[model samples]
Target: MDQKIIKVITGQRRVGKSYLLFQLIRLIQEREPAANIIYINKEDLEFSFIKTAEDLNKYVLANKVEGTKTYVFIDEIQDIENFGTALRSLLLKEDLDLYCTGSNANLLSGDIAGHLSGRYVEIEVYSLAYPEFLAFHKLAENNKSLDKYLKYGGLPYLIHLELEDEVVFEYLKNIYSSIVYRDIINRYSVRNTTFLEQLVLFLAAHTGSIFSAKKISDFLKSQRVNMAPNQVQTYIQHLVNAFLIHKVARYDLVGKRLFEIGEKYYFENLGIRNGLWGYRLEDRGKIMENVVYNHLLFKGYKVQVGILGNKEVDFIAEKDGEKLYVQVALTINNPDTLEREFGNLKNIPDNYPKKVVTMETFSGNTVEGIEAQDLRSFLLA
Candidate 1:
């Protein structure tokens, strides 16, 4: 809601940043009919001439109407060389509101930080949440919709494609290739392409499990693939920087400390993970955990994998001093499974709400003072 600061939207490619920009533009136009708005999409071939700070400044000045505040929206501003210089030059103007979007984290890296000097605010955009996905596709809120969401995942464009297996698979495959080839490989000039592919597959296969770079390297060694732990670490960093995957650290509840080792990785989108692993249903438990992780993030919580003594809690979500201890599972039909999920939260002494989320229909039941809710209602809520 702070309109004064430069709004910089950053996220992975095709995660709906561009669409969000268009929505903002529509809102602004509806609010103020006579507003001066200059929209520039660097990816468009028509604006190919504006590739530098000076070109950007000249183009805006010439098109901007006088005696009115101008709103500038630039898509993929990082494509311009020294974009910070252009932004800084424009910031000196008294009546301009600037917004831009970028797919790479380097848009706000140290170099840009020095140039902008804390003048911009960033809004990180993500793919569609469950409610948004349901509303977008006009699907009913039922078990069938949830199953489709679990298999196809929530890439915005997927709603437009035919829901056939081959079509969805091919679309997801292309998205994965583009993210790797353009965002990671070409941008960073990564030489070990094969290793990068294998690393991504390994991470996708083990979405909710905890593992370190050394462990990954050792696993690869068994397959006759030679990779140093340091190299593996660097490659993983590249993936993180590209916003292709997220790494969550372990928080020890008893010790009140964070462990550097044994961190978990989750994909930015489930469709990408499914595409990488051929949509195999053999690991639904881990896949469901990944879904819960993303949902907690969508709800604006700072999430971490919780470690209470030696047992693992799926997620420790905290926001504005309100905390929720969550456990995710595919089902709690078996008594042993229910104990394992609810028992982990009981170990924690805090009175904050504890929850167990599963795919089972809600029986309106509580296990050992912890509420167990169905995943469908949780997602919509």
Candidate 2:
């Protein structure tokens, strides 16, 4: 927040974007009361005074809110048409630092990017990581805590035990619907809402499996979920925009040719996936992978599902341009399974770090050119 000249926080809805904004603004105001601050939330229906760029401009001019320094806080800025223009206008006129929040990247893609080029920074705010999740729940770091996080997920509000399932999931669903309806459909004028929902649900159910657009399209066609290759891509993009799913392309480090065929899509919140799947025992491995990928992302690693020949790695992460390969399994229980997991990383070329993350609940160790750490240890560390 300090380094960003004009900060924009983007993530899935109810992932604490607005709350983080409120906290930052309160901190800024407490530290510098002399700084003129105007907080406007477009989602607030009471504020009918702000629906467009002209409305915002008229109000700002009428208020005579002149100052040497100004901090404009806009929440759900996508609701305002031409927000980029309005913000750019304000930034040009004064020593202003603009902070805005949105649930998706579309808010900053076309006009917003063009209008605010070289003048803005974007930060991603995801759901609570395991450590934060544990903090919120007053739970100690242990295997029991990891198991709970895997099941319930780390939505901050859900950390309060009293918050009923009916309430928390409802809130999360509304935010998801808003991103789909307002951000994706309304913004893009999409007509196939049914297909989009099916696509999201489909991806949620199959999070960690290697899939391709053609495979999905063919499956949909067989199930009467008919759509073209291009349409599948479009729906996938829309899901990505809503931060509901992320696609990890297969990158062969040895071959260096980015494969277009098979990839994996991860849901941003494991709890959301649980809600979609009704939390089954069969889904535990996926839930583990989901948690591991998110922890890496929260720690500032650009992560993706890794592909090495016929062997597969769960995640390939990069931090400060250095890479780490990871695999998450329920157990290396059988001798055959253990050998397969270790062998995949053993044959890889460079020593860029490798690990097998699991729910075994033991301390970390280096075994056969790769680190073996239990889920609890890996997360807490």
Candidate 3:
């Protein structure tokens, strides 16, 4: 808050970016009772006239308080053309504390970088984490609560709706459409809308599976939807850019390098994935993996799929120069299941923490030095 740098809050649409801005504003108001706040929401028709950079500058300047510092908050700033230019000019004034929210990941890339490099900071927002889900729904931690979380996922607005398939999925499908049609298809001027939706369905069904673009292309060809690997890769990139899904690269644990070919994709919001593809009992394993990946990200870890020899580790999470190995499974009740999950981590050379997260609660269970954690406890941690 003391810095002059602009706080750029970025996230997927409906992931609570505006809510975050409102929270910040509330905090500022509590701290500074006389704070001069200039708020502009592009989503609201009231700000429709402020389309260009000059118009934005004029409005902020016109609304400026005489002597006090102005705390300016712009919602959906990406909606305005040449908004970086206005932000750059407004940033010059020592009296303005600028903050803005954007739904696109590229908000700070390309032209925006040229205008506000080193003059801003980015804070990414995501759908609610598991702990947040429990708190938001006011549900106690148990099988039922966890099941609801796994099925519905955590979009903050979901709190308003009854947690039922018909009602929640209806809302989630609409959000999926907005993200797909408005964010990716419209922004990228996508030509093959049919293939795009099909690709999303493919991703939803095969959530944690690792495959190359060529592999996906080949599979699509078999389905009679022919798209070249390059084009398929481009469309996938569009989905990633839109923050609809996260693309996790595969890392070779032995060679200590990232693999170029295969990668795994997980949804940014699981509810959206479940909404697009029905949440079924058979997909429990994939759902568990996706849930683990999202939780790792929520904990601010840089996560990647790990490959060591023939064994595959679910996640190799790194943060602040430290690493953590994680494996997710439906259960380790079967002896083979227990060994496979822990055995993969045992082969890892270094001494960083290794854990196995499962559906069944097993307290203080350790295999050779690896800790075993239940899904709910792992999420809370």
Provide the global lDDT of candidate 3 against the true structure.
0.92
TM-score of every prediction relative to native: 0.94, 0.93, 0.96
Worst lDDT 10-window in candidate 1: 109-118
Model 3 ranges with Cα > 4 A deviation: none
Q: For residues 7-60, write the lDDT of model 3, one tens digit per residue.
A: 999889999999889999999999998899999999899999999989999999
Candidate 2 lDDT, 34-68, residue by residue in tens:
66777888778866669888887666555435556
Q: Scored by Cα lDDT, where does model 2 land?
A: 0.79
**Which candidate comes out best when scored by lDDT?**
3
- State how far residue 318 of model 3 sits from its true place (Å): 1.1
lDDT of 1 at 377: 85
lDDT of 1 by residue, 196-239 (tens): 99999999888888999899999999999999998999899888
Score residue 23 of candidate 3 by CA lDDT: 93
The pairs that clash in candidate 2 are: none
* Evaluation by lDDT, superior candidate among 2 and 3: 3
Worst 10 residues of 3 by lDDT: 105-114
At residue 191, candidate 3 shows an lDDT of 91
Clashes of each: 0, 0, 0
